[model samples]
Target: MNQEIQEYNESQTTDIKDVCNRLAQIIDGNLPEAESKIWHRHPVWFLDGNPTVGYSIQKPGVRLMFWSGADFEENGLNVVGKKFKDASIFFQHVSEIHQEDLVRWLNKSKIIQWDYKNIVKRKGELVRLKKS
Candidate 1:
């Protein structure tokens, strides 16, 4: 872990960090033996140099950004955050993350890594097609 991740992880409230850590562990568990790296100023889990997932700190929150969030059709994982118009899921607080949902999203991302164009299109479509 980088200093930033360590600092951010430590700075989190026990409840918040607990959730964040759990999320990380879930991602790691699912992608066992994969190499995880710290990049984009955050903790990023990768496989064979391809980004599988990313995480970052936010005001009063943390975000679990998936590389293929747009390809996720179930559980509304694509619309989990205000900035997710790209390909990320932001958890405003630890309480907002459902373990099952996060795991599903991670698995979804892993499965859809090669469908980048479709993923981007879906993300854009969701933002433009959905009504607030």
Candidate 2:
């Protein structure tokens, strides 16, 4: 994990901390090629500079978000973003994280991606960079 991301995980309360640590470990293990850092004040992993997966401490809980997950077609990633191609699921406890599901989502994240890296250049329009 990145230094700042480590601190971010450490800064969370106990339950949330466990969830963050577990999430970080799983993401690192699965997406070894992805770059991880604290983006928008949360831990986010990127593939080829495009944001892929990330998590943040939200009022609801720890939100695991996939930038292109709206098209992943998986029912578990049900919290879809209205303005972007993002999708998410909340986890208040580390136990809620199913390794198989997480790995599956991570795999899908690699194959399904939105061009958030150039959203500024495209003037808020999103383009698909990968597909299932």
Candidate 3:
């Protein structure tokens, strides 16, 4: 993670760390060997260095962004922000997190990452990754 990104993330609410940690647990628990790092001022999960998931803390809620979520058939996942159009989902609370749905989405994201590594590799490029 770059110092500027870290500083920007740190500038958010105190729950930022907690949200990051919890989201990391969720990703790690469901997707074994998933790589994680700070990207675009948020915690990002990757497969083979390609981003699959991302998260950040906001004032009233946490946001989880899934890069390939919209491609899935299910619609139970929450959506927010203008960024939602490009295969992403957002969650305000952990309680709103559906493990099965998330796992499905994460699996799909993993495939997306594997399918087109270079196109989806950049940070803040708006490639889908879950945000919380």
Instruction: Report the Cα RMSD per candidate.
Output: 7.2, 1.3, 6.5
Model 2: lDDT equals 0.92
Per-candidate clash tally = 0, 0, 13
TM, every model:
0.66, 0.95, 0.61
* Model 1: pairs clashing at backbone N, Cα or C within 3 Å: none
**lDDT by candidate, in order shown:** 0.63, 0.92, 0.60
Sliding window of 10 residues with minimal summed lDDT for model 1: 123-132
Off by over 4 Å in 2: none
> How well is each residue in 13-125 modelled by candidate 1, as lDDT tens digits?
88767766766767777778567656766677765555668777777466677765655666554454554433666676667777787777767665666432344656654
The residue-by-residue lDDT of candidate 3 on 1-132, one tens digit each, is 434445555565555555554556668777787766677757776776656677766655777776555555557645454544335555555566667777777776665532324554554354444433
Q: For residues 83-124, what per-residue lDDT tens digits would candidate 2 score against the true structure?
A: 898889999999999999999999989898889999999999
Show the lowest summed lDDT stretch of 10 residues, model 2: 74-83
True-structure RMSD for candidate 1: 7.2
